[model samples]
Target: MSIAIVDARGWQNTLDLKTGEKIDAAGPVIKLVKDVLQRHPYPGDTDPGSNRWVSDTAFDLIDRYAPRFVFLTYAAQYFSGRYTPMSKETRARMISDVFLEAERFINRSGFAAIAVGTGDMTPLLGFIDVTRLDGLAVCTHWSTRYAGLYGPSPDDMKILEEHPHIEKIVSQEEVVRLFDGTPEQTLRLPEYLMLAREGYAFKTISDAMRIPVMIPSLNFNVPLHAPGHTVEAITGIRQILEEDLSEKNVALIAIEGVGLDEFLWPHRPCRNSTEWYYYEPGEAQYLTIVSGRHRFLDYPTGSGYKYFNGAEGAARSYPFSGHFKSIPEGAFASTFPGKSIAVGNKSMFMHMVTGADLSVECFARNLYNQGTMAVIHRADKL
Candidate 1:
């Protein structure tokens, strides 16, 4: 099996020295290709922007070098903000356009496998047809970040249990057992068991196990709390990804009871004040009230879905002070590629999942006052 890796550079940030400012750029993206080509040079000329040219180069490289695998990595900058500019739909469409261009190269080249480094490259996973690719992997230090959240607390194990989304929790010993197990036995365990059966679940067995289960399609009602109360919820999501769903390709969706403005305001105040004036919108603005809520929702699924909820687990929050919003009536099948869905609260959103093909919709209530939700879908379906 021959492999080829492609990496691009220069997409994440655009330099504007004239004003000493940086803006987002469209072309000449930066990625891992340079690093790989440095070690293993490709024959013939290289082309930029032409997906067909890139695809051909990948195949040519594989044919010439005959490597077991090839890795491709790239970066892109995404704009996030409140009102100063574009609407959410417009941003999403822009992203989708870039992704389609990249997919042409990825899907056409027949390689044994592809591995991607963490960065702005994750969203592309949702755009590609994984089934056509031999094997795929993403590299990130997500587990380490998750561990840090515990902050020298021994009760981390207990915290995992109360979390509705986390299905299993285990120690290092278990990891070894699963890795050493036979292929058949490992397959019977969690999806990660394909790598090792002894592996433990992070927050809940649902997070750990891929076994399909029956869950109601209707949405469930839950209460919202202060932002400080969100630690457990966020941590629970982290544990699920690091522990249970680490090896799977998944997407997340978060719904909020409060509008984008109130949910992300500093200090979790009901009303925006001058003290929280730092919440202004900008290209690099990292402090949007909505972004925070979105991060809490996407934290588990490795940022596959940013900002609003996708077709997968639609996590929504109902403010204790706000009324519940009705999801579009009628069941619509989730576009997620997997068999399970995880939710933050139950309500009309939950009902939507139940009515769809989703087998399970795990609900975690009061995890955060802001309504946020996530769903883990299979990659093949994408």
Candidate 2:
């Protein structure tokens, strides 16, 4: 079979077949996807309907094919409350409720191995067989006194170094050196990277409170944030797919905005470590996981990157030029020799990131009500 892409972002596009006719003619997998989309027909990313789309689509896919590798993104609840003004306690509980529901599904669903995010990768080994990889020690930072927005002044940088919440400050040059990344990766990177202490998160100098990254204790022999135990999104996930999923079904799900304290099922299998880079604007993180590289390697973030990057842009339904590179490769989807599929409510991500054999995501324009669309790769067509 070949790679198939399902885009369920907008209302039924101008197609020859009526919506009902299309669903009837489609294969069972595609039919089931449309059914789920219709059931939870809401149109916004933060809406309950969107979250239901994520959970329902995942459950249906698992029951039908039990695909060996499954990746899901459940962030609606996190998105709903992280930025809203509310009491810290009230806000924490709001997010926790959402995590609990998702965790409940994981506990009940019997997968051979599972890995949850917002922590280091090795901790997942406690639940399954896996290897650790290098994760940057990323912290959210904001100026305590200065009103700096973009780049901090040299004098302000000095004060930032001594800020109570600051752990260590870094520059784009330092980031490249630290990660062994190419200079291109540092483009548009914050002028001064102010890392937060283990228990802290920072907002922009002018913004209000920021959420700190939290990971479960997992009761590891060493502390959760212990040095050398941390894992980043890109390599950590690659290791899981390579080493953990050995001829058995595996699920790698990420519940955004839920930190350590908010993770409902800490007692369940998983590990704890810091998310090294910016976790919000999650499209970047998803790309990092699917590509096994930092997003910066491809210039122009998000779907825009698809236009210039040969590996990502190839096979997309939209028009693109493969100028920067030839014979495109790098995305795991491009190389994986298996019948894999990805389904999630995150728009434009399944194809952009995993490029799985069959990838499905919310339709960006209409999101809800409109049925999903599918993309079948010429090489791996079913």
Best candidate (score: TM-score): 2
lDDT accuracy of residue 254 in candidate 2? 65
Q: Any runs in candidate 2 off by more than 4 Å, and if so which?
A: 1-10, 14-40, 63-66, 83-97, 103-109, 119-171, 183-234, 267-281, 291-296, 299-334, 364-382
Q: Every model's Cα RMSD, please?
A: 23.7, 10.8
Model 2 lowest lDDT segment of ten: 122-131
lDDT computed for candidate 1: 0.23
lDDT of all predictions, in order shown? 0.23, 0.44
List TM-score per model, in order: 0.22, 0.57
Would you give me the overall lDDT of model 2? 0.44
lDDT per residue (tens digit) for residues 149-257 in model 2: 2434555655666666555665656656655666565553545455444343343322223332232222211111211223533345565565555555656666655
- Per-residue lDDT tens digits for candidate 1, residues 81-196, read 11114455854554444345345534554322111111111111111111221222111111101110111134443443354443334332353363344444332222121110
